[model samples]
Target: MKKLVLQFIYGVVVKAFLRIIVGVKFDNGKFLLNEKQFIIIANHNSHLDTMTIMASLPRQLIHKVRPVAAADHFGKTKFKEKLSNYFVNTLLIQRKRDKENPANDPIHKMVDALDKGFSLILFPEGTRGEPEVQQPLKPGVALVLLQRPEVKYVPAYMKGMGKAMPKEDSLIVPFNCQLVYGTPQIISHADVTPILEKMQHDFNALQEKLR
Candidate 1:
């Protein structure tokens, strides 16, 4: 009952607030996927970026498409933690911390989620701010792709989100949101590095298109 109520609040009220107040709309949702092991590598510009991403996915997929949020940021406050766990279904991870393998607990948790048929929505830049222009990606995304060679890569570019909720602003600027899905690329075990580079290039291209 609690879960259902939370879902209603997030899926309906939150969606309406974003759409009605912020002028956000989701298109090309049919391009989004389920069933396959996939990674959604998106550009990070605003805090509200996740909503636009979630808006495009079907409800069932929304529950399963976990976002990889930074531990320090999301873990700083209890409110953020609870909200991420409940509304975003985020999979918070510590960055390059230990000698532990990538397949450690958090990675294993994600593997288990995917094993149960969930996908990931990750920002390869790791932090929210990239260059004013597009920037190079963090290796965490590459590591995940390398380790889980079967996962398909989908590059999604978002525009106007930085203006909507810029890093420096406390207030949000209402603007129409844009999200576009590019062709899916498959990276096998042997082609990890090149695949990652291609992923980076693809993301940059998509960002350029948004600009």
Candidate 2:
């Protein structure tokens, strides 16, 4: 039942809204349909970012893609939690960690999701920032990549989402948006610095492509 609902929502409703209503130009979107499992690292701007990415994915892969979202924000209320889980199938993680409980760590949870064969949509920037301005990516993404060195990581850049649905506003404005996907990379390096640098470089290059 859940799968059926997700298929309809993502395949019809979300896809129509993004493509017909909001107008998203997807670059290299075919690459996503061919992969079985992977990680999508994208810039954080508006709440629409996740939906845009989700809508771009092939309808068949809807059940396999899970966006990593903040537990505090998305799971704050019971209704919101149920709605997100039922519709978006988001993997909510605690932004604030408890040192005593290793099991509660966000990286561990993310790695676990990967181990289970679920592709993830990750916003490396911990939270939403100024429109079109990307903040420094947190180390958590590197940590997740380190644990799963074999998984392919795709760098994605979203343009005009901030103006379409800025962090401050609850209402969405109609605007043309662009989503660009870079070549996927498998980083097997042991050091996190080089991994992070590569991600940042790839993201910067993708952003430049849209400009």
Candidate 3:
């Protein structure tokens, strides 16, 4: 169906296109296909970030990689919903929910996906911001780690994407960009406070590496 076609385009064609335009490079990219569960965390800046990150991975792992996207943004329209689900294979979650019940928490859905053995691509910054700028880490990622502390946390940093596809523009510019995959870290703490701090620190370290 359409999903298969999009996946094919993403895995084959689009991946090549991104490499050519952005000059995508990988460090520690071997982790992309390794036999271990990962919660891939990166800074969100451009719409291209998701695709570029996914494209860097091996083609066969495309279906196994699920980007945690904001439901309100990607689920607003039927076409977007379909495209998000099929093309990128995203796990869309509502950002706003009842706070009284942990049963209704959206983080549970992410935890469930992790338990199902699917690798996740999470932007802990919550919303797209200026590329290379340090946005505060959202607690959602820390919440997931608190639940599944054993999952490998991979930090990725991207640069020049804001120029390629800025938040104020819909049209993409052909600008050179780079994405660097950093060493994976683990969270063994039950408290999410320290975990959030570590998430911020790891992301910062990756950004420093990019500079």
Candidate 4:
């Protein structure tokens, strides 16, 4: 209840600042569903990728979406800290040379959320990418699916964002950008790799089409 009010207020502020300053735009947004706990996955291409995804979601569902971000990136800055806590609901995961198994830690919080039928937004690429090309996907999302096949899998592709607002650059490019949310899919344990692979291909194809 308290979270809902904060989401409403923060949603307006976040959306306003983004649309006005970053010039972000959302497209094909009706496909996002509010039913099941979702394992929303997408390609990683730009720094604004996180904000773009959040901005594209429906206001009511916005409070439920949490982005699994690299601890090394979003955790480094004071400004990003607040944004992550508020907007991203940032689940900081270790993406490093010698990382510990997340399953042994507070990751139960993620499992618990799914248990409670909460939705989440995450990147399969793990981190940012090279230019317009998406970064290679990690097996983490699928592993999450294997643990909870009951979860819905949504494939979203954000185009023009890499150019609209890039990493290490404060200047925003005033181009009409968009986010494409495809139909949600379920990844059963049987032959799951192909589904994830195809989804990655489909996501990249959609981004290219949007571009």
What do the candidate models score in CA lDDT, each in turn? 0.71, 0.87, 0.80, 0.69
The TM-score-based order of candidates, best leading, equals 2, 3, 1, 4
TM-score of model 1 relative to the true fold? 0.84
Higher-lDDT candidate of 1 and 3: 3
- Clashing pairs in model 1, backbone N/Cα/C closer than 3 A: none
Candidate 2 lDDT, 1-211, residue by residue in tens: 8877887887789878887888777664667777767999999899999988887877778888899999888999999999999899999999965557767889888998998989999998989989999898888888888888888899999999998899999888888899998988899578888888889999899889999
- Report the candidate with higher TM-score, 2 versus 4: 2
**What is candidate 3's CA lDDT for residue 167?**
86
lDDT of 3 by residue, 134-154 (tens): 688878888888778788888
Scored by lDDT, model 2 comes in at 0.87
State the TM-score for model 3: 0.90
Candidate 2 clash pair list: none
Q: In the order shown, what is each candidate's alpha-carbon RMSD?
A: 2.8, 1.4, 2.2, 3.2
Query: Candidate 3 clashing pairs?
Result: none
Which candidate model has the greater TM-score, 1 or 4?
A: 1
- TM-scores across all candidates? 0.84, 0.95, 0.90, 0.81
Tens digit per residue, CA lDDT, model 4, 1-211: 6467546654677667667876776664546654556877877767777777776777767777777777666778788777677655776656643326545333454565677656777787776676467776776677667777778788888766767767667677776666777777777445658766877777877777776
lDDT of 4: 0.69
Question: Candidate 1 on 89-166: residue-level lDDT in tens?
Answer: 787776654536655455555565667776888887766784244566766666666667777878888877887888
